[model samples]
Target: MLKYLMLVVVFVGSSWVHPMHVSVCEINFNQKDHSLEFTHHIFIDDLEKSFRQSFNKPYLDINNPDVGKTTDELVAAYMKKHFKVTVNGKSALPKYLGHEVENDAIYTYMELDGVKTLSSIRIFNDVLTEVYDDQVNLVHVEIGEDISSMKLTPQRKIDELKF
Candidate 1:
């Protein structure tokens, strides 16, 4: 079901004003590198709407360059505010590497270093929930050889998994 949903969202996410308000996040712990990887998939239109509404700016163009920041930087800041990850009860701040724009959606990448072990993982993702009441964020966490998934909505923004 998750794979089917992901396929649908990726194929049709470029269109403007879709009924579904959703985002996808993938977290992986790299044992060799001792780091945590985060990848977020979000619609371009919905992200722009979030920026405009949150910043109170009428004309915020994510595709075009702004004097304040590049599109990826702007998005990274937003993600830093809306998305959080806690490992073993300690919160981590990830470094935003960059983003990729495909069709009507953008894929953002972030990484946290020096995370050698993981006993418990908690994710708080409220991306675009303020703009859309029905917003849903799907999170997939990978630790060692196991993968765990969770669905986040406006009413519930956080989920925890124990290793």
Candidate 2:
């Protein structure tokens, strides 16, 4: 009995642990500006890996002086391919603003201008899904006082929120 218990402990201790694969996105409708502000929070390591794979680059250093511009370009292109938004059933491509690295995560900003009214929003966020099978993307939308949230996974990549 003691041998079996020891074996169980060893097996549990030696088991491989998978890293957490998740990204958070926040979309807010700015009534005064008539625009939809988008912010995405992603792990820096994961983003670098995805960028490397997508761009076929050997290395991507986030701290390099010249890397900021290249990183922004890569991020914008990646977002354009992986993330999308439709307001009131009309497809609107967001304008890439910029990105900032905070601690271990990267925050990407974008905007969809001329959004006068928002009745429904369709979001398709597949960031890192191609690389990580267990990737999960969480999205939160704030339209005035009303709010909506959705969880996107590999199987279900798109979700429509009605406000």
Candidate 3:
């Protein structure tokens, strides 16, 4: 009886100790608008920790007025530095639209306008790699009627897909 009790306690404790380090990014090529729409999903707590360490702030409130602007600026800078997309070997500068908190995660939106065609796409995603060693960034791209995906890590940060 005691052995079973110990095993249960250990299982519960271990489950709570480790947090999943993952982020998901979805990219859709809009044929009508000739644009690429990107959306990134990350845990809010993990993002808060990254922001706090980067900005040296005691606390970051996404809902607050002053902190909101600062958060947006930091997010934009971070996204530009860590996330990149290239179409047909030419780098496309994605404009950071905005971010919103949904439940326990934050969704950031970005778009690359005036993209004529997507013959080949190259993605470089390093989000949360600096903070977490085991971070995994998963990207799913939808172009026309086909879809391709890649998993990125610290060692392998870039992936290219040809359509």
Candidate 4:
């Protein structure tokens, strides 16, 4: 009995036990408009889990059409708090442009205008890290011809993308 229990524990602790918890964020610096556009893609299931923890609603479902406005507000508030970016020591408050559900993922859009230059960019993406231990947030930044990417984890919440 003890051997069987130990085997089960070992199997559960393996890589197969880890769930796929990841979010992707794409940022493009529009030279013509002199602004930055942000798009975040997150899995619906992972987002629902995080929302449930934040709102203390165990059965919360963000995909439900009946709770449209409420869910939008929740999502906006959460994104505002968890995901952030600053360029050249100046913080850009993302203008929430709402979100869309495409297949199994929810894609949120935001843009920050009046960004004239970027010597350095600091990204702080905590997304669903608060809810999942192995959560990974991938950030991709594009500036003219130069493009860079970084991985943000719970331990490393912030990262810089240099041109």
Candidate 5:
């Protein structure tokens, strides 16, 4: 009976093990309009509710006075402000797209008006990597070493696939 119970526990526990150290975002740029589309995914240990509560406050009113002034409004404002973005060795200023996924950290989307050809942009303590092209459809995002070696199992077969 003990052996059977142990097997059951292991089976249940195995399904819960997910990658905890990685996050990813997809960015698309439209050079014709001088605009950029950004999709961000982050991996964290906390649940969606906690992540939302900690960062998104006041229920995120898009029309609020404190919200976006000149650029397209962003959903995860806190994440954008803290995360670093660079394009071709220069800073890339991004607007927000007001979508949020609180589970395992916030996954959101946004657009910036003045994006150009970029070489690379990295996020999540540099754990998520994106390489851009002349036209700006994200060429690839290389999930870093820290995430690959974590105890958590790969969430997708793509997770194990690398650049």
Candidate 6:
């Protein structure tokens, strides 16, 4: 009986382990032109591989900038177009995680999700830099803070289904 119970525990624990991550971001709202620029930094245990894979998405041109924007700016625009805040299919926004005001830049910690699926569309906002080239506003996103092990989502498991 004890042997069976021990086996069950091991199986459950091993299978339940998941990859969890922490995200840090900053939003620079230039009230002057009604534009918002954001910078996000993510820190995870395995950054090189995970960052590239997780953030890997198709590039999008919101309005076709004449001179093209930075990679970060482009990413920001793409996010705004595709991402939305929703809790159970309702509108939700990023909540304050923390903040730091430097001499020239004010870094804000706007966390999208403490717990979320890898494929989930959890955060979005306009990348002003994609618009006007002059005095262009921009949003930057970085993924690295801490990624821990947790239970995997049903969808993730299904997606990972192997033959």
Top candidate by TM-score:
1
Please write out the lDDT profile of model 2 over residues 12-108, one tens digit for every residue. 3333432567787889899999999999978777888886776577887755524446778878888999999989999989999999987667889
**Of 4 and 5, which scores higher on TM-score?**
4
lDDT, candidate 5, residue 79?
Answer: 47
For model 6, the superposed segments whose C-alpha errors exceed 4 Å read 1-91, 120-124, 127-163
lDDT of 6: 0.32
> Which portions of model 2 miss their true places by more than 4 Å?
1-18, 56-58, 65-69
Best by lDDT: 1
**Model 2 weakest lDDT span, ten residues long:** 9-18
Worst 10 residues of 6 by lDDT: 154-163
TM-score per candidate? 0.88, 0.82, 0.83, 0.83, 0.43, 0.26
Candidate 3 lDDT at 129 equals: 90
Question: Model 1 over residues 1-163: C-alpha lDDT tens digits?
Answer: 5555764755475374477878888898998999999988888888999888877888777888454788977888899999998888998889999999988888999999998888888899999998999998998887776778899999999999988
Any runs in candidate 3 off by more than 4 Å, and if so which? 1-18, 65-68
Which window of 10 residues has the lowest lDDT sum in candidate 1?
9-18
Overall lDDT per candidate, in order of appearance: 0.85, 0.82, 0.81, 0.79, 0.40, 0.32
Superior candidate under lDDT, 2 versus 4: 2
- Residue 151, candidate 4: alpha-carbon lDDT: 89
Provide the lowest-lDDT 10-residue window in model 5.
130-139
lDDT tens readout by residue for model 6, 1-163: 4333533443334344513332223333333433334444322222222223444523322233223464335344444443334433335454444434332222344444433322222333222222212211212222233222212221221111111
Deviation in Å, model 6, residue 140 alpha carbon: 4.5
Model 1 whole-model lDDT (C-alpha atoms): 0.85
Rate residue 152 of model 5 by lDDT: 17
Candidate 5 has what TM-score? 0.43
